[model samples]
Target: MTVDRLGYLGFDASDVDAWSRYANNTLGMMTAAKGKDSDRYRLDSRAWRLAVHRGEADDISYAGFEAADAAAFNSTAERLRQMGYQVTNEPDDLKADRGVIDLVSVIDPSGVRIEVYYGATELFEVPFVSPVGVSSFVTGEQGFGHIVLATPDLEKSMEFYVAGLGMELSDIIDWDLGPGGKHKLHFFNCNRRHHSLALLPAPAPKHIHHFMIESASLDDVGRAIDRMERDSRILLTFGRHTNDHMYSFYGITPSGFAVEFGCGPRDVDRSWSVVRYDSISMWGHKFISPE
Candidate 1:
C-alpha cells in the first residue's frame, strides 16, 4: 500500500463538550462541524482531520490512511479481501462530510480499525483559523500526525503494517519498567515525521496510548504545557523523546484519554543510513503510564 499520508482519525468520546473545548483551547484545532453521532475538527483547508464519535468507551475508533490515488484505494480494498479482512465504502453523507471520494475500511489481525481513502476535497477560499493562536502544526509537509496503539500480537501486527501496509521501522526500544520488567516497543514512520505509528508490548484488543500533532516550535510545546496546567488538564512529564526528538508533554483529553502535544520532530531522510539506539529518551520524560 503506497500510503502517502494520514487521511483522518476517529475517536470515541463521552464528553463531546470537553473534547470541543480541549481541541480549541489546548490543541489549537478548529471545529468543522458536530452531529448526533460525531464531531469533526479541521486542521487545514480540508474538511476535517479528526472525528470524535459517541461510543461506549474512550479509545481510538479508527485510523484513515490517504492513498496516492483512486487506483491505490481499489487495490487496498482487494488486498484486504485477499487477507480475509472485511471492507466497506463510506456512505454518501460520510463521503460528503469527509470530503473523500471513497473510504475502504478494514480490521487488522489485532482487530484494529483502519480506513484507506482518496480524493480529499478542499476549499481554497476559506481562510484557516488557527485555534488558540497556534501558528501551525507540522502537518502539510509531514502528513497529519502519528498514532500509537497497544497490540499483543507484535509480530503479526508488524507483518501487516510493514509488509502489508509498507511502513518502515524507524527504531525499536526495549523498555524495562523496573526490576524484572521488560517491554518491547517499535516505531514505524510512513512519512518523514519520525514514527507515524508505534506499537507497544501488549496483547491484541488493546487501547490507544495517544496521538500526536506537530507544533511549529518548541515554545508552542511549552505554551501548551502551561495552558494544560493552568486549565487543570496536565497529564504527564514535560520532556523530550530521543527517538523522534519531539519535545512534548501529555495531557488529559475531554474524552478521558491522553493527548501528546509536541514540536520539532526530527524529519527523516530516505537516503540516509539507519541509526539505531537502545533508548528513545535522553531526558525530561521519566513517567510512563500503563493505562
Candidate 2:
C-alpha cells in the first residue's frame, strides 16, 4: 500500500457561489466548472486539485490519495480487502468526473471517504495562472497539501491511515487546553512535505478541522493575510508550527471549515525523528473572534 501523495479534495458546501469567490478572489486558485452544481479548483498542472459541490454538508466529501502507478493502486485495494475493509472499484462515470484513470473507494474508521487512484489528468500546456496573482503553490510531488481531520476515534483512525495506508508517523503534538484537558494530534507523512494528513480526537460539527494550502512565496502569505483581514475572515493569527514549522494563518472558508494558508514549511527527510511537542505553534495562532 504505497500511497504517493494527497492528490485532491472534494467538499460539499451549501453555497457554491461563496466558495467560488473564496477560492478565486482570496485563495488565488484557478477554477473550472465540474458540472452544473460543482466547481473544481486548480493549484498547479493537475486538472483539478480541489472541488466544491452544492450541498448542505459543509464538510469534506472525499479525499483522493494518489498511488505511484496502476500496480500500486491495485495492491492498495487488495491490501485493504485483506485487512477486512470493503473496497469498491468506482465506476467509469466517477473516473471521468475525478479525471483519473482508475480509483477505488473505502471508508475509514471515522467514516471519512477515501479514494485511491492513479493517472490523474494533467494540463501542462495550460499553465496555471493564479486569479489573484499568487505566483505559485507548493504542489507537485507533495500534491495539493495537507488535511486535518477531527476523528471521534483517534486510535482507530491511526490504524486505518498509518497501518492500512502505509503512511509514516512524522510527529505528535500534545496540546494542553487547560480546562479542555490534553489533546494529542498525530501527524503522518507519505512524502517530503511533512504530514499530508493529521488526526485529532475531537467532536465537531464537521469532519474536517481544516485543509492546508502552501504557497511557494512567503510574500503570497503576507498578501493573503491582508485579504483575510480586509474580509474579516481570519480565524487564527499568523504562526509557526512546532513540528512542521509552517509559517501560516487560518482563515474561515465559505463552508465554515478553516483553511491554513502558509509558506516555508520544513520538509521531512530521512534523518527525521518523531518527537512530541507540548504546543501546536511556537509563536502566534491566536484565536480571532468574528465579533
Candidate 3:
C-alpha cells in the first residue's frame, strides 16, 4: 500500500533557541513544550508537525510518512522488505516519544531516515494559534506539506520511493544551469497534493534541499515576506513554480537548508498528466543573498 501523506519532520538543530524564534515569529507556527533539549511545533490539529532536537547536524534527522491505518502500515513495511530493503520496527518507548501508535523506519538510497506509521496524536481541544497570526496551514488530508531531497543517485532514489514506497510520478523538471550542466528533478505524489516528495540529482552538504509548508491565505504569505526581509533570510525571491504552480518564497532556516512558504498550489487529480518542464519556476523565484 502507498503511504498517505507527508506526516511530520524531525530536525537535528545546532541552536534550539534560533529554531524556536524562527518557527514562532518567522513561520508563525505554534510551539509545544516537548522538552528542554528539544522543541516541537504544531501546524494544525496534530500534536506536532515538526520537531527540532538539539544536535550539531542542523539538517533533517528523519521524515515521517503516515499510513492510513494499521493494515496500511503493515503492508508498507512488508512491501519494503520484499524490495530488498531493511525495515526496522521501532520500540514502544520510541513510539510513545513520537506520539504514534506504531512506527517502522527505513533508510532511503540517499541515506535519509523514513518513518512510516499510523495513529498520530491530535490536539484539537487545544486549538492551534499561530504566534505570528497566520490564519491556518493547509494540512489535513494533504499532510504536512512536501520535502525535496538532494541525492547523488537519482535513479536509485526514484526506485526506492516509487517502486518500493508506491509513490506515483507527478512530473519532472530538467533545469539547465548553463556551464554548470543540467539537473533533473522528479516529483512524486501519494495523494491530491500535487507532490509530497521530490528528488534532485546532485551533491549537497545536507540530505534535504528544502521542505515546503503551504498557507491557507495569500495574505499570510505576503506578511511572511515582510518578516523574512526584515531578518534578511530570503533565499529565493517570491515566485510561482512551473510544475505545481506554487506561489512561494524560499527562506534560510536556522540550519543552512531552505524552507518554502507558499499558498495556492494546484492539486493532482485523476486527470493529471505527467510532463517535463525546462525551468523551475514560471515567474519570479530569483536567487537572492540572505544578507
For model 2 the local lDDT of residue 185 reads 88
Q: What is the alpha-carbon RMSD of candidate 1 to the true structure?
A: 2.6
Clashing residue pairs in candidate 1 are 152-202, 152-203, 152-204
lDDT of 3 by residue, 82-178 (tens): 9899999999988988999999999999999999989999998999999999999999999999999999998889989887778999999997755
Instruction: Count steric clashes of candidate 1.
Output: 3
CA deviation > 4 Å runs, candidate 2: 33-37
Write down the worst ten-residue block by lDDT for model 2: 31-40
Off by over 4 Å in 1: 203-206, 273-276, 288-291
Candidate 3 stretches with Cα past 4 Å from truth are: 35-37
lDDT for 215 (candidate 1)? 73
lDDT (Cα, 0-100) at 69 in candidate 3: 94
Residues 1-291, model 2: lDDT tens digits: 589899999999999888888899899999864743579999999999998988999999999999989888998888888889999999998898888999999999888899999999999999999988998999999998999998999888888887778899999999776676888989999999999999989777899999999999889999999988876489999999999999999999988899999999999998999999989999999988878
Ranking by lDDT: 3, 2, 1
- Give the per-residue Cα lDDT of candidate 2 at 282: 95
lDDT of 3 at 150: 90
State every prediction's TM-score relative to the real structure: 0.91, 0.97, 0.97
